[model samples]
Target: MSPILLTEDLTMTYHVGKVDVHALRGVNLSVAPGEFVSIMGPSGCGKSTLLHILGGLLKPTSGRVIVDGEDLAAVGDAQRTDIRRRKIGFVFQRFNLFPTLTADGNLRLAEHIHGNHRSKAELAELRREVLGLLGLEKKLHHKPLELSGGEQQRVAIARAVINRPAIILADEPTGNLDSENSEIVLDMLVRLNSQFRQTIVMITHNPEAAAIAERIVEMRDGRIIRESQPDRGAKRG
Candidate 1:
């Protein structure tokens, strides 16, 4: 099968006063359908830039980004937004849950924003299934403050996947959780990929977190320096 995501010679440059800062320099990357890949890099190394470009949040200065066969670089703003909404789900380091919204309410809000046309019954069933998969069924009516950090992050993940997007772009998904909670969140991500064959590209600095991926990509100075399969047998963090 063709790759679900592909980038060729991706580059992004920002003009900072008198100098041009390059965030990505000729980065070439690809992620297979339903494959889980992790990107590891130091600060200011362009991992976030690459992820943003892949998710259609930013256009590369000069390169090609093809997501599920749609060329992001060639699309207009509205089209890019449409593609992102329909094909990509994003999980950030911050949970970003609304404090006043219950877990179920947060998820339904996402569905509403995504313009899902499913009937109420179908939508409710999907919401319950996603929450159950993420182990948040019992906390459905609880607001963000009522849940623990891990539970809130799980709710964020649930909101991202509720629409069953083609790919999930996770930026330091476990960064804010304690080690115990980090392990739980990582395991849930693995289970999601294993059970539904979800395509995932995660950006992380932690080796233990990166190991959950089938492949690990290392980057520095705005370019990918290496790629290898992680040793899953290593001791957990």
Candidate 2:
């Protein structure tokens, strides 16, 4: 099977004042369908930058990004946005939920924005199934403020996956949670990957979170340094 996501010699440079900052340099990576991969690096090492480029949020200075077989560098802004909406789901450290919206409301908004063309009944069914998978069915009416950090993040995950996008890009998903909550979130992610065969690429600083993925990619100085399978014998956080 072809990879769901691929980046070829990806490079990003920002012109800040007199100096050019290279956020990514000659980075090549691929994530196959139904695969879970984690990227780990210290601050300013370009993991997040790579994630954004993969998600089509930022156009790299040079090189190609292919998502679900479409070359992102060849597309215009509108086409890129359309591809992102149809093919990629994103989870961030911040839940980014609206305070006034209930959990179900937040998910419904995503469906609307994603232009899910299913009938109302089908859409409702999809919402329920996704919420149930994330263990948030009972809290559907609760707003973000009424839920715990873990619950909020779960709802965020549900919202991201409800449309069954081709791939999920998660950036520091457990960064804001306590250890207990982080563990819960990580387990939910693992369950999602294992049960649904969701293609996932996560950027994390926590080794424990990275371990949950099938493969761990280490990045440094704007390039991938190494990639390896997680050691099952190693202790998890």
Which ranges of candidate 1 are over 4 A from the true structure?
234-237
Clash number for every model?
0, 0
Per-residue C-alpha lDDT of model 1 across residues 103-200, encoded as one tens digit per residue: 98998889988997788898888777787889898999999999999999999999999998889999999999999999998898888887778899
Error of 2 at 132 (Å): 0.9
For model 1, which pairs clash? none
Q: Identify the runs in model 2 with alpha carbons over 4 angstroms from their true place.
A: 233-237
lDDT of 2 by residue, 1-237 (tens): 989899999999989999999999999998889999999999999988899989999889999999999999889999999999998899999999989999989988999899977898888787777777788878999999999999999999998899988788999999999999998888888877877888999999999789888899999999999999997464333
Model 1 TM-score, 2 decimals: 0.95
The global Cα lDDT (0 to 1) of model 2 is 0.90
